[model samples]
Each structure stands twice: as C-alpha cells, then as structure tokens.
Target: MDAVEHFVKFYKKLDNQSLTELALLYSDNIVFVDPVRKHQGLPAMRHYFAQLLQNVSTCTFDILQVDKADPTVTVTWVMHFNHPKLKSGKTVSVDGISQLVITNNKISYQRDYYDLGSMLYEHIPLIGSFIRYLKGRLAT
Candidate 1:
C-alpha cells in the first residue's frame, strides 16, 4: 500500500483497537505535530497515541474535505470521542485539519491543526472558570 492508504489504515485500526497495526504506519524518524505538542520519532508518537486512545470509549472520524498535492495530503475531519470523563460524559466532536507528508510509502511527517478553544478550553469547569476569570481581568 502507498503512504496515504497506510496512514488511513492506521487511523482505522486505531478505531478498532488494533493498536498493533500502528507499528507499521510511521517511519522511525517521523515527526508529529498537533495543537498540544510536537514529537519526533515513532516512540514518542506511540506514547502519545497510547494515552490518547485509551482515554476515550470510542472514536470515529468523519471527513469533511480532502485535498492532495503530490506527496502532501490535507484532510479536514471531525473526530468524535466519547469518554466518561468529559464534562458532558457524551460524544464530543473535535474538528481539525491534518497535513500528511508521505515519503517512500510511509508517513514521514504529520501536522494536525485544531483549535484549543474548541477541543479543550471550554470543556473543563474549573479551567474554564479560570480562563473566564483571566479574560475578564484583562478586558478591563
């Protein structure tokens, strides 16, 4: 399979709890970037996914748009994660665009663009309160 198919397969495997399939999706020196962090190498990527996947009950991706130019593919999708710890204890949809760079039939780099405000800021009661308080303090 080509790099794009490999990456999509990895995401599908994730949703199915087939974590072992993730082993082949990334290059040893892969670079992954997202709203919260930037990680280099497969080890870091694996660690990040391990925690992230385990935190949710179920997750699914709905593609809104996709554009591909040579080795770079950009995809806009809504990823819904249902987790008990979420403030609503319900499905929360986080929408984002991901840019994937395919090299030699493997994903060499990936960057996820998502809003912190939409994914997290307003989700927490105390943290949301703190952010509001800080916003109010600065606005005056």
Candidate 2:
C-alpha cells in the first residue's frame, strides 16, 4: 500500500495499542497542527496523543474520502469520541479534513481543519445552547 493508504489505515485503528506504530507512519521531525494545538516532532506528537487518549473514553476516526497529489494528501473524516467531562459523556461527532505532506514515504507534516466551536464549545451546557442558537440564526 502507498503512504496515504497506510495513513488512513493507521488512524482508523488508532488507540493505546497502536500508538507505538506512530513511528512507522510519521517522520522523526513531524509537524502536526489542528484547531486546538500545534506540535512539532515525533516526541511532541506522541505526548499530545497520549494526553488526548487518556482523557477520552473512546475515540475513532472514519475516513470518508482520500485524495492525493504526489506528496500532498487530503483526507476527509468524521471523528467520534466520548469524553467524561464533555457532553455528559455522550459521543460527539466532528467532521474535519486532514492535509498531509508525505516525504520519504512518511508523513512529515499534517494539518487538520475543523470548527472549534462544533467540537468543543457546542458541547458545553450554557455555551452550547448559545452557540447553537447563534448558528441557527446565521443559517436563516
């Protein structure tokens, strides 16, 4: 399989057990960015995922589509996760896209684009209601 295919596969099966396989997919000097945080290097990325997985009860990614052009790959996915402190432990689904730059058959850079409010603020109690109301108003 190609790098993009490997990446999608790795993320789909991501969990505590699959963390050790990160090195196989990401370069040593990998740079990872998302709406909430930016991390550089494999060590930093590992630390971030470790903390993230520890807090969430369960997390999974469903790759909806994958497009690649030579060194660049874009993947659309839905992330489903349940956190004890968020949304009363109910599952939250967020749609997002990941842009990856592959080098030497390993992902060297990755950036994810997603709505911060939808993934976070919308899960809060009062804030969630207000955000939803605002979104509804803007839509119509």
Candidate 3:
C-alpha cells in the first residue's frame, strides 16, 4: 500500500501496542504537530504516543474522508477514546483533521486540527458546565 493508505490503516487500529509500527509510517525526521504539542523526529513521536495512549483504556479512529494532492494528503476522522480522566472513562468522540506531507514514501510532516474544548476541557466537571453555559449563551 501507499504511504497515505498505510497511514490510514495504521491509525485505524492504533493503540499502545501498535506504536512500534510508527517508524514504518513516518520518516526519521518527521515533524508532528497537534492541538496538544509538537513532536520532532520519529523517536519523539513514539514517546508522545506512549504517554498519550498509556492511560487510555481504548482508542480508535473512524476515517471519514481523504483528500490527496501529489505529496500532500488531508484526512478527516473522528477519534473515539476512553480515558480514565475524561468522561469517567467512558468513550468520547472528537472530530479532527490531519494534514500530512509525504516524502521518500514516508510521512515527513503532519499537523492535526481539532477542538481542545471538545476533546478535553469540556470533559472536566466544572469546566464542562461553564463551557456548556457559554456555548448556550453564545447560541442565543
């Protein structure tokens, strides 16, 4: 399969165990950026994923669409994860998009866009309530 296809397949079944396969999908000099933080190089990416998934009970991705243009690809997906600290360990779904730049048949750059409030802040008790109230107020 191609790099983009490989990426989609890898992420669809991503978990702590599958993290070892990151090298197959990303270049050694990969630069990854997300709403949370930035990671440079494949090693850094591995460490980041390790911490991100270590406490998660489950994590999955539903790929919605893919837009490709030569060396660049954009994918839209919904991430479903259960975290002990979020939503009482229940599943939380968050919509997100990832843009990747492929070079030498490996992903050299990737940046993810998603709402922090939807993925984290809104899951906190007091923060959730306040955010909901603000959303409600803004909607009216």
Candidate 4:
C-alpha cells in the first residue's frame, strides 16, 4: 500500500500497545511536530506517543479529507478522545490536520496543526471557564 494509506490504517488501529509498530510507518530519523512539542527520531516519537496515550481512556481519529502530491500528503481529521482528568471523562473532539512527507516508503516528516486550547485547556475545569470567558470577551 502507499504511505498515506498505510498511515491511515495504522492510526485507526493505534493505541498504547501498538506503539511499537511505529517503525513500520516512520523513518528512523523522522521529525514530528505538533502544537505542543517537537520530536526527532523514532525513539522520541515512540516516547511522545506513549506519554500522550498513557492516561487516555480512548482516542480515535475520524478522517475528513486527504490531499496528496507525490511525497507530501495532507490529512484533515477530527480526533476524539476521553480522559479521566479532562471534561469528567467525557469525550472531546478536536479538529486537526497532519502534513506528512513520505520518503523511502516511510514517513520522514510530520507536522500537526491544531488548537491546544480546544484540545486541552478548554477541557480543564477552572481553566476551561476562564478560557471560554476570555474567548467570548475577545469575540465581542
């Protein structure tokens, strides 16, 4: 399968246990970036994913669209996740997109764009209220 197809399939089935299979879709010197942090190399990527999923009760991605041009592919998706500390374990959905560069049949570079406030801070307790209020104030 093509790299984009492989990525979609792998992510749909990804979890803490399946983290070891990251090598199947990423290069050894992969560079991954998100709104929160940046990581280089497969080991760092594995660690980041592990930590990110450690406390997650459940996490899944709903693919919305895919645009490809040779080695570059842009995937727009909505991530739905549940965490005990966030929103009282209620499911949270965040819209995001991933830009991936395929090299040697593996992903060598990946950058994710998403709102950190919506994904995290907005789900917090006191912080949620404060942030929401601040947003409303700015909108008015």
Q: Tell me, by lDDT, which candidate is best.
A: 3
Worst 10 residues of 4 by lDDT: 11-20
Off by over 4 Å in 3: none
lDDT of 2 at 17: 43
* Candidate with maximal TM-score: 3
lDDT of 1: 0.78
Write the residue-wise lDDT of candidate 1 on 82-106 in tens digits: 7777657778788899998887777
TM-score of each: 0.83, 0.95, 0.96, 0.94
After the best TM-score superposition of candidate 3, give how far the Cα of residue 12 lies from its true spot, in angstroms.
Answer: 0.8
For candidate 2, write residues 27-139 as lDDT tens digits.
99999999988899999988988998899888889999998897899999999889998899999999999999999999999999999899999999999999999999999
Task: Write down the RMSD of all candidates, one decimal each.
Answer: 3.2, 1.1, 1.0, 1.2
Give the Cα error of residue 78 in candidate 1, in Å: 0.6
Model 4, 71-128: lDDT tens digits are: 8999999888999999999999999999999999999999999999999999888999
Ranking by TM-score: 3, 2, 4, 1
